[model samples]
Target: MSEPVTLRVLGTSVTLLESIRQRAEEELGIRLVYEIHNVQQAQRIAVMQPERYDLYDQWFHNVDFVWPAGAIQPIDIRRIALWDEINDLPKRGRLHTSDKLGAGSLPSERLFVQHDGKLGSQPTERISMLPLTHNADSFAYRPERLPDTLAATEESWSWLINEGWCGHIALQSDAAIGALDAALALQAAGLARFENLGNLRLDEIDQLADLLIKKQHHGHFAAFWSDDQEAGRLMLDPAVSIQSLWSPTLMQLHRAGIQYRLAVPKEGYRAWFGGLSLSRRAEGRVKDAAYAYLNWWLSGWPGAVMARQGFYISNPPRARDYLSAAEWDYWYDGKPAREELPGSDGLPLIDSGERREGGSYAQRMGHISVWNSVMDEHNYLVRRWNDFLRARKAA
Candidate 1:
């Protein structure tokens, strides 16, 4: 007579939750119905219709404006065993009072890290969301197009802006401001100085204006993508050559038998993370079930599954316990085009570490950047970018 316990989670696909639900039911003896909602819809439900969703899965960042608006609960996970497996426990704790674990098994997600230095060793209190999984940003290039004896090294960031490749590559239309951000980092670190921060400044119109001018004079951009799929299409063409890319997008291309390399440019890797959080109203069995699900996901198996697929895990050591040597080599050093990327049977291997029987991967990296007072300038950045794009188009 009563409705089945509906665990409405905002974010992720229905298929993902179905897997979790099946596991929870079989492993934890809990029968639950699951529903998936989009991030935008989840935000509105969290604020306007609190009763709608029992959970929310999404990303937390300096530029994303949803969390501060009271759209989700900050979880408390200090007592949870899985929290110990996460490298960035303090930072994740700070974001969501209720989010305490990663979602699914994946290798690329080892541990979480944040180099704020301001927090010292204190446990984070103003929680918003827990990291479900994370990924890094890297360059995707066709080896055939690059000159022999390429000089880009992974230790520095300057190799990306070489004048020779200026117009030939495709840059993200939405992420154009990131180029300027990288340039600013160069100035901040006293590595290399670039004048006219105006060019680097995040003014949308200004960025558009600059790009338009460049397009007229250079005819360099092979193509521009509004989303990752479009970018992947360009990469598969081979004729399009190189582009700034996120590893997940590259993974999809790799699965399709595409040949591309993760550039070890002079600059270090660029990346971001996302996580899961509970609704403020969730309690009792639902909460307990969620916690159980969270713990199983982070303890190694799921973490390794995600990592070997391209996205680097936040907890590497834990994932290593689950992933095999071959899987590890394939992810860390092996190229998908050069070898067959193992799959989870017929599935796309959405989470690769799942293939590992008892793998565990841990985290790496010392610092993470989240939305904070100093990094809260994305509004200005976005506005400036719009201006840059508009101006560039006119030019």
Candidate 2:
């Protein structure tokens, strides 16, 4: 018998690794070695020592910058026959265009084939990296607690962050710093920005930092969260009442019996995506095995499991087949997937299809208006954001 292909994965959660392991070993005829690491630790290992893992589970939103730094290689997707099966979204598809992608990033609706044998502008190149699942960000709040005036206008992103609701706001942790940019984009559209104070820009951060320093402020944040689990917890508990959150996590919380409402907000929620990538150091059969694993993930049973778990799949078509009509209704609306799925607070989640879309949420904070797409500015913004946080921490 051929030797089993041992695939080591870093920065994946135990649940996710277990799922992958079951699929890879049972289905792929390959041996799997999986390791779980937090995002920070994974980045540190990748930077400090390159060969720690063969495959790294990284978020796609930030993965593009790593390629230029030699941390990872563009995936050779052409080797995987199912490459054509995967769905490529706007920002994600543009990651390999030799052009930096950010807010206003264009979509590659058509498939480009490989060239003579490289991963670049040529259409026929191998795929650089494959993403697994992603979370969509949007505004969420407790419907019961919100004032009738605002709750009545829930269709818009503006109502949740309106001045009347600002004082009760909370933001996500710094890891979810992108939520800050989303807030800025909303403010640019003449909507009210949540005053988390933690996610402010370099100049704007000072005032926020000062307020936080004085108030010793702590509230549920409107920012994106670093820990996937916390999103559910925060939604269940009224820490800040209103903030940006991932769709799946919130849905999971609702299913677990929490009572909360999520909307795109008037300005729309900032969208971020996470996926899988290959370490540049991986070679030989391991790389080939990794490709196999990626392909397997895109097709077959695992993709279904992931979609049902509340995440958006990069392989949309395959994922759709996995979810039932009821699941679609639950995802599309706040309703329970079925009688078995309960809201986070132990009640049934709101099922009004009209309710989710009726508010000013889409008008004020929609995705198109909210993302800061200037790719060139990402470094500057990230650096300033980090520095501002540093100063805040020191103060």
Scored by lDDT, the top model is: 2
Q: Which stretches of model 2 miss by more than 4 angstroms?
A: 1-3, 12-17, 88-124, 154-163, 166-168, 175-224, 328-395
Candidate 1: regions farther than 4 A off: 1-4, 12-52, 62-64, 88-121, 124-126, 147-163, 173-227, 281-289, 314-318, 329-341, 344-374, 389-395
Estimate, for each residue in 2-119, the C-alpha lDDT of model 2 and write its tens digit: 8888887777451354655776788878888776665556766765565888777765434434555667766765676666665545324432444333243222211222353323
Candidate 1 lDDT over 1-395, as tens digits, reads: 54334455665441234545575567655565555554335445665654566666545442134444444455666645766566644343322344323221111221221144121223554344555566535456766666444544332333344444555566565532244434433443454443343223334334434544454354545555555566777777755667776544655765787766665433233435656666666777667666666566666766665664454444556777876665665554332323344542224442333222111122222222211111234456556545434433222
> In every candidate, how many clashes are there?
101, 51
TM-score of each: 0.65, 0.71
lDDT (C-alpha) at residue 34 in model 2 = 73
**Residue 150 accuracy (lDDT) in model 1:** 53
Candidate 1: worst-modelled 10 consecutive residues by lDDT:
365-374
